[model samples]
Target chain A: MASQPHSLSYVGCNFLRQRLVLSTLSGRPVKIRKIRAKEENPGLRDFEASFIRLIDKVTNGSRIEINQTGTTLYYQPGLLYGGVLEHDCSPHRSIGYYLESLLCLAPFMKHPLRIVLRGVTNDQVDPSVDVLKATALPLLKKFGIDGEGFELKITRRGMPPKGGGEVIFACPVRKVLRPIQSTDPGKIKRIRGTAYSVRVSPQIANRIVDSARSILNKFIPDIYIYTDHMKGTSSGKSPGFGLSLVAETTNGTFLGAELASNPQGQGTAVLPEELGLNCAKLLLEEIYRGGCVDSTNQSLVLLLMTLGQQDVSKVLLGPLSPYTIEFLRHLRSFFQIMFKIETKPSHEELQGGEKVLMTCVGIGFSNLSKTIK
Target chain B: ASESESDRKGIQNAPEKNVDGVEWAESKAVEDEDGGGDVENLLKEEEEYGEENDFSADTAGALKWKEDLTQKAAEAFLRQQQSAPNLRKLVYGTVAEDADEEDDADEELGGLFHVSRPDKESKQKANALDCSKFPVETPQDWDLDEVMNSIRDCFVTGKWEA
Candidate 1:
């Protein structure tokens, strides 16, 4: 691809996905230079290459050029041509890494995106498939992108190192999203979770559920953690166990937290009960960081709000993540939009930490590529 | 001077009292002070120019405008700060420059291989791991009764507003 002088130029390999995503959405070309240029074994890694490949697959006529050492990547973004697609993501990172960008781009596609993603479903790194299914899917529905077609189904659970997971994600395309006003995230009414064990003993799942329930029951009696014991083919190549808990508020807010154990041979063997209790503590920490959306899905909701119809959208979020902060800057560059951010101090006592109120008028970007049927 | 001082106090108390928010307010207030000083110097230069033309120290009406210039700028600064939320500016306003300075320090150290400096805080921050989990910074001791009571209102069983 010939580098256009007007393209937005950035340095380093960090935030490559966001730069590409926003550029694709806004139809602006981007040039990323000095990607791992200073490192001993310089240039883009396999995982990043996989991400770029996935991006190329999902779009139409996107011209991507990387230099001899694969350090510099110049991408001229094409139209979002979404269709039924399947891609095997690199096992270096979890499927969640790829899914995060897809969530941002799926709704604005030409056709509804129905993609089957196969890779590490759960890992210590990145937000797992369960958490995204529990938290991000519901958050998308708030912007009125809901129908029978919208779903994220995990057919197989895979752990890190040797991943063999499979999950199907389908989202309906929308012409224009309704601008949301979600300032109030009401009191959590119930706690729900999935304690999944694959290729491990079935009793381990029970042990996890018992220990997790012991901790969470102190707060709310409406706690129900289901133990999912996948057998045979549904259990992926790697053996692992983990927990994903979601706290549902009275006003339909879902704050989710998940913890996957160490892989089969990564390190010391983890006790299921200990993993369960620690995961419960993580859930408590998430509750303390309570907001309309959880920390993991903060960027997703913000992106949706930015792309919504041209009306004011306000959301109360607890503490912005570093990724979300960078996303905000990228949003400003790509869309020429900035959010009205305010720190909302918690009222009275015991209500967790400081919440950030983000207000922005949506760019009113309609899906021009969507075919009229 | 008194007006500007009081306005500074108001600027301090204008934003919500979080650790980050307070620090941001301080940074902005410092910028405002710098801006105020520059404008005051410009006004002084203008006053000197006027005195060069007409040369009278006792022209009270003319001198008062110069005196009020800083006061007015301070007041305007406070007003604008109060009106628009500065949190957004704090987050995305300025990029950290320490990393750039360090990068320039070793542009061509050995002609072949440039000297690589140790990773500074800003360097690590710029190329930090991209994960969306906002880890608990100051973990609250939930064992204590006082700490437990703080979050009681968050639950249905906790105290509800009337």
Candidate 2:
């Protein structure tokens, strides 16, 4: 247990989740300091603290230490003893914040992870559960992390401010992930979306659908947007409406865009029609970017590629988001893996924007804790 | 105003005037390296040569051929910039591997007073909110006819290339 590799040290609170997740996956120790050190409330925010607690719940024998002021933290990761667990995520940030990290760590766990995450399911910040369910779950399947058990089910709908939503995420464990080579995104065949409303008029969902369809119908006649208006206990605490759109390509690529109304008592009130129109435009922008994986899941794809079975994995992607760029840097520090990134200009006419072709060989890390039948 | 005053002062000083002339000649020689000045020099020599050969057409055609060479080169460079940006270097800086080497040097500053060494950009990024959603920076108006037409080929209903 004491024979771990040299610990990596970093400063600041940004990207704390990735650093810890990578440390757990790579079996490394990490020390982070100066979390909001200069601020009036200098320390890890409640949401980040909640995230660390969630990480603790999933793993076994992990060592975590923080200073009195909580400005510094040292994490020595333990085995990913993933089992049935539940967490009430801090509502300041949406559950997407926690779910994104869980998505990366789930497949490599000893036991298949079945976790119930309760918090804001849809919010202005972070990728909503609906978008991830539609986009990321399928992307994981492409890497062969699929089985009868893989599922992300939203039992309740919650908006921000006073979140009461709950979602159950279950993923099957894999000893080794299959390397993928997905360069061609192919043409989009159809568009599907969900317009959800809670504690608001159910008619709001229909108005969103109609406005979004009006814009999307010009591209393809195959368009379907479901209206989900959860009521009673399933409706959660706040009143809100939003739309999440996903475009599926002929070659199994998914591009997604979503917009949620501002959390109750925050910002200006958003009109459903305006939100729908803007969300449709956002989807168009995503389609124009045109890659094999959605922008939100770019880092997830790269992470899976790095953990594949000692084989080269190549993926074509749109512009690298700033968050994804930092995740790449963190991957290097943890796994000592560097991606060969090449920009591929869209040579074909009417095919979105410029793309980047990423190539990397996996570290061939196999799950040691996985019990053999 | 300052630039004009400096030029006037340089002219008033005799030694400075000579130095300025030398610097101008040096820049002209550097421009010759770019082949701009070289072409004019070659044409001048050719005009003198053509005085004997009586071939005016060759020199005129040479001048016309070199007319927009610099402009064409500039356009080609801009096209390259728009197309193939070095994404690897963009994502991971050139010194990414050795980025921690500076930290070791900075750590030992004066021993007693710990040096806060994080630069402005990294310091700001260090505490920034961590969220994965990439919002659109500049959304294209979907109502515009040309914007709608730009992505027309992305759909199955669009024409398939034979």
Candidate 3:
């Protein structure tokens, strides 16, 4: 090697392969050589000397030894090794201190190699307890090691009444090197709606089916409501009265109503709410206001209403029609008034069941007005 | 011979209908003529001739006759002691003594019977295998001791990264 370059770069290589590519700095190849036992790396030597001095100061001038062989370096702080630190400390904390030191020296390394820190104590307060407490997750993230690839294994040792033992903290350096992908989808193209399957109770199902059939039967008098309701309208002809009303426009075509009974003896109306309520609201608002609307607008409104009907069918007999909502509001107010009607003990004795009978009559009249509308 | 005569007389004097009737009478008459001599030899000759051709009375037949006599004698003894107190205990004691004697007789007979071995060499060869000499190999991938030591050091020394 004739006058090899002074600066050297570290690159992964297989010595047996007999191929070498030197890392270049300033348009020149740096010398690639391993540090010998006698000839230590200048930076490493400086670090050891400073670290030992600090330890000696902390330990009140106690002797400290730095053993270096090949690439391995060991530090032995005789009697004062653990004396400088608190007697009882978390192992994680100590490991965190080591990691912090490593991060400070990271810029000096020619090539970054993955560092694994294993074992931290949590079980009992022992010699290694400081290491366990020192290694906080936030501290690790600070060192650019916040990724799924970074792994940590912590061990806890038993003390005193239990037993003194070793704990481990393992932190793999791969986490810092791994790439992160964006989790968010960039733009909103079309709004997607969620679908929910609803079960209808038997009493409610029967009421809905009966009400729907009753409405459909009004269209074609002679035609059977259940059978004819399912049949398509005659060519170029609208469905008869009740059926036509039930077959409201949903997305340019009349969204047909499906009559199905679930396991619970309840009928279910299956329609997408997006096509039902939303479209229906838009269509009905335009239609009621006498605004000129295209066929698509009309169909979209109808589809939204049909979807609204499916959504409401689980609870109510009919779709969430404007009239139905108004009626419900009225009924709710009426019930509130009824609740406010105070009855003294004496009044109760005088009226007996007559007051109840009168309340029922009032409810019946209210329901009749709502139904007619 | 004289004792046999007395036994024949005793059977003849027994309730006539209970004298084992015609079939037993014939057997007894043949036994009396043969004088119970060489009964086993006669049975061996009969067996050599095959069971179908055997003319000598079967051992089973003799056992059955003995059983019948024993049952009759037991019944008679029980009847005689019907009025005695603790009759069950007395009967049980006598039965136990008889069982012990039978067991002793069976042991003697069993000792007299011997079976020859098939092969001495093969048996000895089968027992000669040394099971203790073969050593068991530890699994290559799993060094439990090293892992355990690592764990122990980590926990005791509070050093997590090694």
lDDT of 2 by residue, A145-251 (tens): 99999999999998999999999999999888899999988788999999999999999999999999999998999999999999999999999999999999899
lDDT of 3 by residue, A1-373 (tens): 3553333222111110001100110112322122232222321333223333433332322332223432322222222111112122222222332333333222122222233332222111111222222222323343234455333332322222212223232233221121111111111111111111122222332233344443223222322222112122111111111111122211111111221212121234233222223222222221211111111122112211221211211110111222222222222322221111111121212111111000111111110111121
Candidate 3 local Cα displacement, residue B94, angstroms: 99
For candidate 2, what is the total of clashing residue pairs?
Answer: 0
**Candidate 3 TM-score, C-alpha based:** 0.14
Query: Ten residues in a row with the worst lDDT in model 3 chain B?
Result: B127-136
Q: Write the per-residue lDDT of candidate 1 for residues B32-127, one digit (tens) a residue.
A: 335445445445644554554353233344233443333354456556545544567656776553356557677776788776666556555545
Worst 10 residues of 2 chain A by lDDT: A343-352
lDDT of 1 at A221: 91
What fraction of the genuine interface contacts, i.e. the true contacts, does candidate 2 reproduce? 0.77
For candidate 2, lDDT tens digit of each residue in B40-104? 44445445434533432333332344333333444554465446655666666653325445665
The DockQ value obtained for model 2 is 0.42
* Docking band of candidate 3: incorrect
TM-score of chain A of 2: 0.99
Candidate 2: C-alpha lDDT? 0.85
Model 2 alpha-carbon drift over 4 Å, by segment: B1-78, B81-83, B94-120
lDDT of each: 0.82, 0.85, 0.25
lDDT of 1 by residue, A185-289 (tens): 989899999999998899998999999998777788999888888888888899999999999998999998888889877899999999998888888878888
> Which candidate has the top score in DockQ?
2
